[model samples]
Target: MSTFGTLYRVTTYGESHCASVGAIIDGCPPGLELSAADIQTQLSRRRPGQSNLTTPRDEKDLVQLQSGVEQGVTLGTPIGLLVRNEDQRPKDYTETDLYPRPSHADYTYLEKYGVKASSGGGRSSARETIGRVAAGAIAETYLKRAYGIEIVAFVSSVGKIHLPSSIAPPSAVPVNGADDNDDVEDSLSPEFRKLLATISRAEVDKYTTRCPHPETSERMTKRIIRAKDAQDSIGGTVTCVIRNVPAGLGEPVFDKFEAKLGHAMLSIPATKAFEIGSGFRGTEVPGSKHNDAFVRKADGRLGTATNWSGGVQGGITNGEDIYFRVGFKSPATISQAQETAQYDGTPGSLAARGRHDPCVVPRAVPIVEAMAALVVMDELLIQNARKTAAALLPAITTLPPTMVLPKGKQ
Candidate 1:
């Protein structure tokens, strides 16, 4: 389960309190330029102690490239990466011995594996994502170089404090006591579409909340600070967009593009929900109103007048920007006292002691971008392999015009 992707495989390792955490990336194309600094940029963004809103645990999160490169160029071999855990405080997790840590993975991991790490959340910790980010950076570099692909993610909401672009009209009165939002607002509002088209990482990082909008980012900062002051936690959503993707990527049925994306996003620690395009809102809108209308793009390729489908049609990329949102639950390792059952089924009060984030969406932005890159990269390679293999075969001129693509049309 540690590994992901088919051709561009990535396997991550290490625990929260371990000496080091990293990933091994296999199947990267040879001769691509790479360096530790490139990977470090994203790692730094994801590291703890970025601001008052996040955990106070200070980690440099410095990256070291161990293999698969020579003279700053990838060798097309398995790329090994490592980031040492310098500021680990295993003693802070002493309460975990008595309690499973409410809403945490401590219980489930032990139940499934029959044993769990003695300190921290082990593989369930966000530290495990170090390798993913590293591998994704490589995939991103390749994607950008090969297709000018651009991926950007940012905080869209913190608890109830949502960006104006993300706000939707209130739900209509329940019909027959059924809950539905038939008064659905346009998921791809003109303002939101413009933001997706132009927002950059630099603009997002300017504010600690990473919301981009000045007013909403300030409110989100206050919201996170309030939770930290109360020794509680909050949940939020992250939205990501990928642009300049060519049409016709993704497998049908089993490995649909969005399905793989959901798998990757939900795999991150604290993630609770995943939605693409119109998401849940689409359910309420009539099919005629929700459908994306085809239009001719300036590049002579087909596009949608309305992107309610979020750039994907029939589970594949459609040459439009692919966008989605990921929801992260409140962090479970808060320093709050709670009455709960212990591992042995005894009643006890646990006041957990550990430096943890009050809200995770700001730091989760890069993880979202990284996972998106991996899915796109893997699907791109698969599609490319199929195209390459099909090119070698004799032309099928006997097929009906409706059944086969016309020559030079592709």
Candidate 2:
């Protein structure tokens, strides 16, 4: 579905080669400060042509806020945002009219709709996600203000060039006297854990690759450049951490928090897999090693000695940092010649043309962060409504099962 989220719903419109692309965000709470600059920051990160490894197409991706805000404050109405397509090259895709690009959405779209957009695969294009990132930034901004939630995502790997073992831990390991959460986790100092684990956008944006570690980011960049030189693409992983989320944010069974998170991440263009907490690695360890022991925190709340659960258990937030990884497949469009059949099932040789990312993780970072924010924001509203209802349960107990108290009393 083009629309996402329950309470904080978003409906995206337009296509990659269309005149403009954007999203309409509904259910946004009012009275928060918002502006075009706030959404542009993330859109710039998700925009094309920012680095040597990504597409050469340079798009300003300047967002225009059409409605739902007045005097820089949201009005609790549907927010409409748009970004014009100033650099789209529909002619660059004239060749694909003959045969569907391998591993792309061309064939499936044509099969499903009996016709498909002739340029950039239409809705299949990464360009379509521009609206998502914009809407996500809004959700993230609200989350930060309302709950002090911080969502940071970075490229963890590119092709075979994984970050060194010294750096590739699933959790954010702040260093020095900074936010290294390692030591504070096992003790009663949950306050210290919060202090040490905070990561700012400045740190994440320091490198073009978005990997905070200088040495590892260089390797990832080189790997992407190498793939571009070979006319092939490489796949990689993106890790996102959401911190300062209080407990009880997801529903049981169907709307489990992590399940919704996975749904959001997989909806991205090239994302192939999603994992949270220890993910598959926990299977390699014994039960004793994998389990997170509980402790009484300095704030008089139950805290985990370790966060192997990645801040969530039973699909709900546990007040720990929620960290997860998303695996993106190599870009399907490349310049290398390949043997393929046309729509008529006849043999053909094709060399795909046009700009595409040699590695998508760097650009995917913000997109992942955006999706994560949307999920959490929706769950937060649901949980808040639950709290509102639970608070009134006692007063309504004497009424009939289907009845509700009068407005003034409630």
Candidate 3:
């Protein structure tokens, strides 16, 4: 059951301290440009030792494209990718054979599997997510090219240190600045101008940390420093928004859109909660105040005045920005010692013995975005295939006159 999605199936493999870890993506359409470089961009973001706020595990997360792609395009085959584990320290967890870390899956893994890889959390390790992120980047590229869909995620909060409302807009999109030297600078397309304006309003590049706001980034950095020094960890929420998603992307009944997204989010290490539009807050509001009002746009497109449904209705996308939030628990391996039990059920005091993060929300931002992109792209492909099949039905039943003449000539 490691595989996910009915259309775009993704199967992840390998362990945290194993020789390598990777994913195999099936159902990718042929002719889409793909390369290892595309996947690396995302792996670099989730790679450990990237910053002071995250774990200090220094691995170069270099990806190897194994199959499915030829030259630069997909061959309609399963795409295989691998990321080697260069800086593995399995010895750190060798003691786990006796002392199982509290609040970790060590005890449960042993009980369920009867046998488990003791070093690192094995399959349960966050390292396994590298494959997921890599595969997701490829899916994202296809989604963007085919549908102009975009996904962006950012750290909204870290523990009690929250960003100001004015700093980060809830659903701001990222944009690249225009170059003054370009001859086409003055003749910018309307789309480019709109993108620039959005970027300017979002202020995404104002901070070196890629945070949407400068003051918020500074405050978040300070909070991470404080938490590290106190030998504790902090957790927070990540918000993701997918724009321009087409309608009728998800299947009804068992395979709902939100359910697929939930499966992906919960797969991330430390992720504890998932919520869609309105979510828990909707319960507090009356039905009238919570419901979205449908309206027609100037372009004759259907739109919603309010997005309480989170751009999804009847378990399918409704051609709106799909927005959701995921909650991550603090890193379990903190420096502070706590009372716990050994594998033998004896009393013991345990202090985490490896390099770990004071906060994981910042790094998790990209992971969340990657998962959302993967799901949306899969759904897009499914919808497109269905449409193509329906359009070909009449043509398949009868040959065209042009085809008959050509056959006789041949």
Candidate 4:
């Protein structure tokens, strides 16, 4: 199904090479400030032709708000947003009809639909994610205001180049030989704090980008350029961390919070795998070593002695950092020619010709963060609805005789 979520639902439509692609956000809370500009900021980030590291297909990706809001505030109706395709090169894919692109959805789509769009990968294209990113930005805003939750994601690994352990891990790592100090407050001076926050905000505003640490971002950029020069594409891993998520935001049994987040991550194009908390590594350790020990704080709050669980237990947030990793496949459109089959099943060879990212991991960082924000925000809204329902139960129980009616009679 194209729709996501039960209460805070988002239904996306259109294909990559279609005239336009957009989303309808249903169940958005009324009175939330929103505008085309808010959605445009996110679209700009994921738009192509931004830098040498990404595809050279340029599009303005301007957003057109259709309905569900008035005077920049939600009207308690479905929010509809659209982004028209300004640049489309169907000629680039004319040959695709004869031979499917390697590792793309071209063959699969044809098998299902009996025909596929000749321009780009159609619905399978990363362009399909524009609607998702736009809707996610709105979800993120609500989450920040309602729960003080923050989502941060960065490219942690590209191909064989892995982020150094010194940067941190899925679980907090000891720094400067200090232990038991999970809360590492911003140690920068007031001026520096302001500078960093400004930079962080700018990154979020830019949407499809980030530079949490400028030096690191620059270094990563250089590596991507070098990889491109080799005529090869690289895959990498993105690490996302969610902080300040309140407890009881997720349901037990089926609708686990992490499961929803996993579904969202896997939905992104090129995403190959998903992992939470200790993930695969925890399987190697004994239960005693992997389990997070419980500790009671002096303020009477419960905390974990170690965060191997990554702040989640029994599929619910435990008021600690929630972190996960998403792995993306290498870009399939490398320059090197390879032996393959044509559409008629004839043996042949094809060398992809196009402008594509040498490494998608860097650009994928923001997309991962956006999806995480969307999932968390939806959960928050669901929890609020449940809370409101429970609060009214007692009042209903004490209602006057005149107000109370027999179920069948009412």
Which candidate tops lDDT? 1
Runs in model 3 deviating more than 4 A are 165-211, 392-410
Write candidate 2's Cα lDDT for 132-164 as tens digits.
999999998899988898998877777776655
**Rank by lDDT, descending?**
1, 2, 3, 4
Better of 1 and 3 by TM-score: 1
Q: 1 or 2: which has the higher TM-score? A: 1
Q: Model 1 Cα displacement at 289 (Å)?
A: 1.1
Least accurate stretch of 10 residues (summed lDDT) in model 2?
180-189
TM-scores, in order shown? 0.95, 0.90, 0.85, 0.85
Evaluated at residue 2, the lDDT of candidate 4 is 83
- Single out the weakest 10-residue window by summed lDDT for candidate 3: 180-189
Better of 1 and 3 by lDDT: 1
Q: After superposition, how far is residue 61 of candidate 1 from its true place, in Å?
A: 0.9
Q: Candidate 1, TM-score vs. the true structure?
A: 0.95
TM-score of 4: 0.85
